[model samples]
Target: MGNLVGSWRFKEPSTVEECDSTWGSDSESDEPVAEDDSGISDSVSPAESERAPGHSGDTSPQLSDSPESAPKMKRSFYAARDLYKYRHSYPNFKKSRQPNEYRNLRFYLNKIPLVPDGIYIEEILSKWRGDYDKLEHNHTYIQWLFPLREQGLNFYAHELTQDEIKEFQSTREAKRRFLAAYSLMLDFYGIKLLDKSGNVARASNWQERFQHLNESHHNYLRITRILKSLGELGYEAFKAPLVRLFLEESLCHNTLPNMQHSVLEYYVYTIRLPATRRRLLRYARKHYRPAHAFLWGPPLKRRGGGVGPEGGVGAGSSGIRAPAPTPEQQRRGEDSPSSPSASSRIIVSSHNAMMCQDLAGGGHKGYAGLGSSMVGLEGTILMAGAQRDRNEYNEIVPL
Candidate 1:
């Protein structure tokens, strides 16, 4: 067994907002930028980040065999690995050298059946791709379907390696299989990934799939894993749109209830492009309310001064209505020093409102456990059985 370090090991971002705002410089490369709606010209070239090794249309300088080029190649690899920052710190800081488990992922990518079922990548995509029931009930498939550099929930599956990542990124067959796996998961989430542009849009059954997502809290972890895996596998181009869509629907449209927190905390930082991440952060800041203050990456500053007397510049003024104070408290008046009714107004979003309705109509039968889980913090839910990283893996040994 061998341990490899330097640039490949996952490092959690110390300050997420600070990291996102400056990770990738706009002048990093001359690659075309995706124009922001607000006409921001800031762009992080794909070559500087997720552009595959042998991908066509790439203008980045190629690595050479010369000793002088070695350092440049190393720097490029390091830049590529900087695509994501884990919310939770890496699993083991004491261990200097982490395990590099690549054989299983390599064999699996090459169409060899590593799992006990003897089912390979082709069969999984062709036969079991659309099987939502099997996907949900069967836990083993996720680790293989979305291989990560870190440890996953499935102990049976192997973690990724630098070599395996290169193979998946550069080789034609492995890249195709990777995209197929991504497409399958996208369909499962009721999203359609466009073939040419790599942009994602809502699938025909988005409503149905979204409703199911609200009903179940377990998939949130899966989503977090998927985002992390995509970042690791050089699919950073695909991550931004999906995350943008999630934020738009959940925060702005209110269509995706119970998803805002997970998306904001677990999904956003996985984006490789700095400009896009900043744009989404700005949007979230603008649309989100005081209820979500705790979730913001940077310290949310008070705009137009603090909450003033006469309920000015407060929750009431910002469209978040506070519950009517008890008659006794009201009679005591706003100036009463003894009044202890300063509890932050609980924002009953449409999802919570629906939960209330379900409660009124004879208990939450189908939506069992969702209401409680939704209210819990991101760390609480993530630490409980959610596989954040695959740090534990069998090291590679030379024969």
Candidate 2:
């Protein structure tokens, strides 16, 4: 089987200068000693480490730097730091038998021949590149192919480490393999990653891809994870174009249909950059419609006597006002602005028809204000009768 590859405050370390000068001192400090990256420090001997309070005096695990049996590791502060710094490159390393993300990564880069499950990385990559059925059905391979900092669902594979991430980024071979994997996944999603221009565009197979997308709800989640992983890795530059393509397909061209509004909301939010997120939100606002009733509201008034999506009073504009009453209409004097208590008159909004229907029943309490406008969920001004829920004593109280 193809194996799916899946700040603690430390005590302040003494500076290298301090460690160099104070090495011969009589005082013994439990804190980790600092050293340059020139292998192990000679200040603390293995005999002293074994005689220390927390040591078991047994031979420590050997990390093979070469084919020959490496030196026995000691349990000291400097030793611990060394172990942490060069954790990834250690030979004969084991962590409960399951391969770490670095091992899986090495497999993919062809550094190692096969994964823990005995499947060759090339064969796994080949299957991933063309096998849509396996890609859709197999859940474990995704974490291995596109590893991220977040924990994955594959229990058989270990979580990614910072050392592993740096290794992947620094390796030329790994980056090349990553781009190939990215291109493959893009093709699977009906997107073509243009090799020459480094841009993304709709593939010729979009119709077939759309059928696959609509057939299962899991595909939506997979797309979300793919986007997140892309952003988490060094491929953030590829996100905006892909997102724009998705928006255009779902909203403008209507080619990719039946995309849930909620899923689109999350998909857009997965973009890491704030400016990119805001720009995409603006794009979505142009084409997207709110499914939530609370999010539905009238157009807001913009500055300079213009209307906006989020309601605001125009410059020098009179506040919420009741309609002008005719001669025959002034008989009841319900909405007459000419009345003595004109501020107390109920000023209804023509655009608040839906809001009126929501607050139609008599159990709600009415809140009357002179020039105050109630802002709805989408920032639209509610110029109609603003309401509040009655308290336990049946009294209207402001929250």
TM-scores for the candidates = 0.54, 0.52
> Residue 235 in candidate 1 has what lDDT?
69
* Model 2 vs. true fold: TM: 0.52
Candidate that scores best on TM-score:
1
Cα-lDDT of candidate 1: 0.50
Q: Candidate 2, 343: how far from true, in Å? A: 13
lDDT by residue (1-399, candidate 2, tens digit) is 223321122232333222121112212232323322221122211211121111111112222223122221111333222222221112122222223436646866876644345555566666667677876786666666666443445655544444555566667877777777778877887889986334888788888886676555555545655665555445656767877887787667766545533233345545444345445655555565321111112222322333323343211112223235566655655464544454343433322332433354321122232112223332132312432321111111000
Predicted structure 1, TM vs. truth: 0.54
Positional deviation of residue 229's Cα in model 1 after best superposition, in angstroms: 1.6
- Compared with the true structure, what per-residue lDDT tens digits does model 1 show for residues 1-399? 234432244343443333344213323232434422211111211111222121111112232333222211001121123332231222222211132345445554664664655667777888876788877777677777777655655667765654455555666767677788888888888899986457988999989888877655567667766776776566666777888888888777867757765576446766645566656666666676443232332321233223322232222112212234467646764666543433522333222323343444533342333333233343233323222321211111100
lDDT of 2 at 266: 42
Q: Which stretches of candidate 1 lie over 4 Å from their true place?
A: 1-101, 104-110, 114-116, 290-294, 300-399
Instruction: Give the clashing pairs for model 2.
Output: 5-144, 300-311
